[model samples]
Target: MLHLRVVCPQGRTADVTGVLRDEPGVAHLVVHPGVAVHPAGDLVEADVARECADDLLGRLADLGIDHDGGITLEQLDTVLSDRADAAEEAAPGDGADAVVWDELINRTGEESRLSLSFLTFLTIACLLAAIGAVTDSPVTVVGAMVLGPEFGPMAAVAVGLVLRRRDLVTRGAVALAAGFPLAMLVTALATLLFDAAGWLTADALDALDQVDFIYEVGPFSLLVALLAGAAGMLSLTSAKSSVLVGVFISVTTVPAAAFASVAAIEGRWSEAGQSVLQLGVNVVGVVVAAALVLLLARSRSRRRGADRALSDG
Candidate 1:
């Protein structure tokens, strides 16, 4: 379930209340007239079933409440009331299967922002990957993938395409465009330092180990990328955070970038090109797969809603 706290102009309270009251998925409604000080409006609160959240939020948006006021949603980890159960039962679909687009968008928006902290994490992750690549350590490659912060922008792109939000698309693209190149440049510079320090020798760079896969983009890479993309999208929408960690560890974006950086520095132009191709394949595959999954989920949700409406009528 989700808890929604709304602040709306005094005149719109009736409209807001009516919308909430009419929805079978909403319960424990409370209204506090003229209670919102900063927004200078009435405060309304309710428990909403997740299955109905997207539609309910859309209705609220149609009222221009978002522009004139505010709405915030919080997940109710433990709702002890029978009322909450009733709300869930009254909703058309299963709560666990619901998209809860507002929550999804908000979460990804925060995650996808290109902040200094994000850049720092990306840089550090790429550096680790570069070291791992030069050493041909599969364990270190996996660690670098886990540490990378590239998934946020990938998810943002998916959500942007799903919602037709150009701002999100632009922001996501900008983040990727800036973040990857920055990570690559930093990794390259760090590789030079490692080479100068004699820690990364030509023999180490040419080691016949896991690093070979990083620079060998092939059909198998495409297949793996497609699978990872689907799983990543499922993890995000289903709130399966543990599964998301697995998804992060399974992708090759970080390793590919790092491998490309190190390979270029070592004058392995062909290997660098292949590594870049691997990165591009994974990124493109992920975005395309994620967008498709979201679209399909939303379509199913809408169909279920339509069926419920017909039955009710």
Candidate 2:
């Protein structure tokens, strides 16, 4: 279930309440009139079934509540009310399978921003991967994968494409476009320093047979990317943050970036080309797969909504 706190203008409180009351998936509705001070209106609270929240929010938006006031949503970790259970039962599909498009779009939008923290994590992850590549350390590579923040923007771009949100798509793409090059550039410089310090030798780079997958683009690489993309979308829609950790570790995104940095630093142009290709293939595959997954999920949710509307009539 999701908890919604809405602020409504004085003139629109009754209409907002009406929308909540009419929604079968909404329960425990409360209205406190003349309580909102900033916008000067009423405060409304309700619990909504996760599966039906997107539609309910759309209805609220249609009522101009979003523009006239504000709507805030939070996922309830635990709901003890019988009414909450009834609301979930009243809605179509399992709560865990719900898309909650509004929530999804908002969450991904924030994650995809080109913020300082995002760049820091990306740069550190790339640097770690570069270290792993030159040292032939699988543990370091895995650690870098665990720390990489690339998936968020990719997922955001995919979801944005499905939702037709140009801002999200542009922000996500810009983050990726700018973030990767900056991270790689930093990693390349770091690699040069490591080489000068005698920590990373040409022999070490050439002898990394175990880490060769980092630079090799193959069919299995795309296959892994496809799986990662599907799993990533599922984790997002289902609100399973833990599942994303596995997705992060399984994909070849950071490793490719790391390999490219080292190869370029060592003047291995062919190997650098291959590594970049690997990075591009993985990113494109994940984006395409995630978009398809979100598209299908939204389509199914719409169809279910249509059927319910007909049955209600």
Candidate 3:
């Protein structure tokens, strides 16, 4: 639920009130006449009955209503009692689970289209990772991982699945599939240039040859991917954006790809293949984990509605 506040010019209060009265998801309408400050006529407060705050905001914007006013959930609950029945009636049932599949596909498509910023960040990340691999410095490798913007698409894919948005899934998948190859090609070119400068060392080549971790993919990596995916999604969905910085470091997608590029440049074919596999594993793991998390969040929301209905009954 969302609380919406509207401030309108004095004469226009009635017009705004009339508009909101007909909106489907709005409840707890209150009109405070003669509430004025400089350039303001009246203040209106209300609660939205739906969970989709973005959709609600769009509707309000279409009505030409200034939504900068603040409303509190507690105040809304105290003012409105009639919406309880309506909210209960709108609750979902078990069959709503199918929406998850649809959302996954939709999100994938949305993530596929790369923005200019995304491309720029990815290129820099791949370059950093390649450098890190050549230097055999874990710190630089982690820095490259943190710099990569791949999680945006991964998180979008998860959100699409949870929201049952087929378009998002397609976009996300396209972005992920395209992004890696682009990063790989650029990194490969950079690696070759670096190697030509005689900067590639034997130790770096040996580091790439150590392929034990790639084949050892098991529950630990999966768990880390899952946690990182969940954190990434939460950061995207919530106001707490700083947390996503850590999430970028927790996943191995960029680092592994960098390793692969470095290995290829040094003529370590077997190790390059292993690094490729590691990158693939991380990508798949994060996507799958994010999908699951979104599914769970949606299910929990549905269950809350059901429980509220039972209590009201």
Residue 128 accuracy (lDDT) in model 2: 90
lDDT of model number 2? 0.90
lDDT of each residue in 222-279, candidate 2, tens digit only: 9999999999999999999899999999889888987888888788888999999999
lDDT of 1 by residue, 83-178 (tens): 889989988877767887877888788888999998999888888888777777788888899999888898998999989988788888888899
Residue 221 in candidate 2, Cα distance off native in Å: 0.3
Among all windows of 10 consecutive residues in model 1, the one with the lowest summed lDDT is 201-210
User: For residues 1-313, what per-residue lDDT tens digits would candidate 3 score against the true structure?
Assistant: 4466776677666767776675655666788886857445678887754343333444455656544332222213343466844642453332222122222333444445687777778888988977776665667777888888888777766666766766666667777787788888899888878768878754556554333343235677778887887776655444345888898888888877777777777777877887787777788788887777667766775675578559759
What's the best-to-worst order under TM-score?
A: 2, 1, 3
TM-score (C-alpha) between model 2 and the true structure: 0.97
Clashes of 3: 35
User: Candidate 3: misplaced stretches above 4 Å?
Assistant: 1-113, 201-203, 207-219, 310-313
C-alpha RMSD in Å of predicted model 2 compared with the true structure: 1.2
Clashes of each: 0, 0, 35
lDDT agreement with native, every candidate: 0.87, 0.90, 0.66
Instruction: State the weakest 10-residue window (summed lDDT) of model 3.
Output: 94-103
Q: Each prediction's TM-score against the native?
A: 0.94, 0.97, 0.67
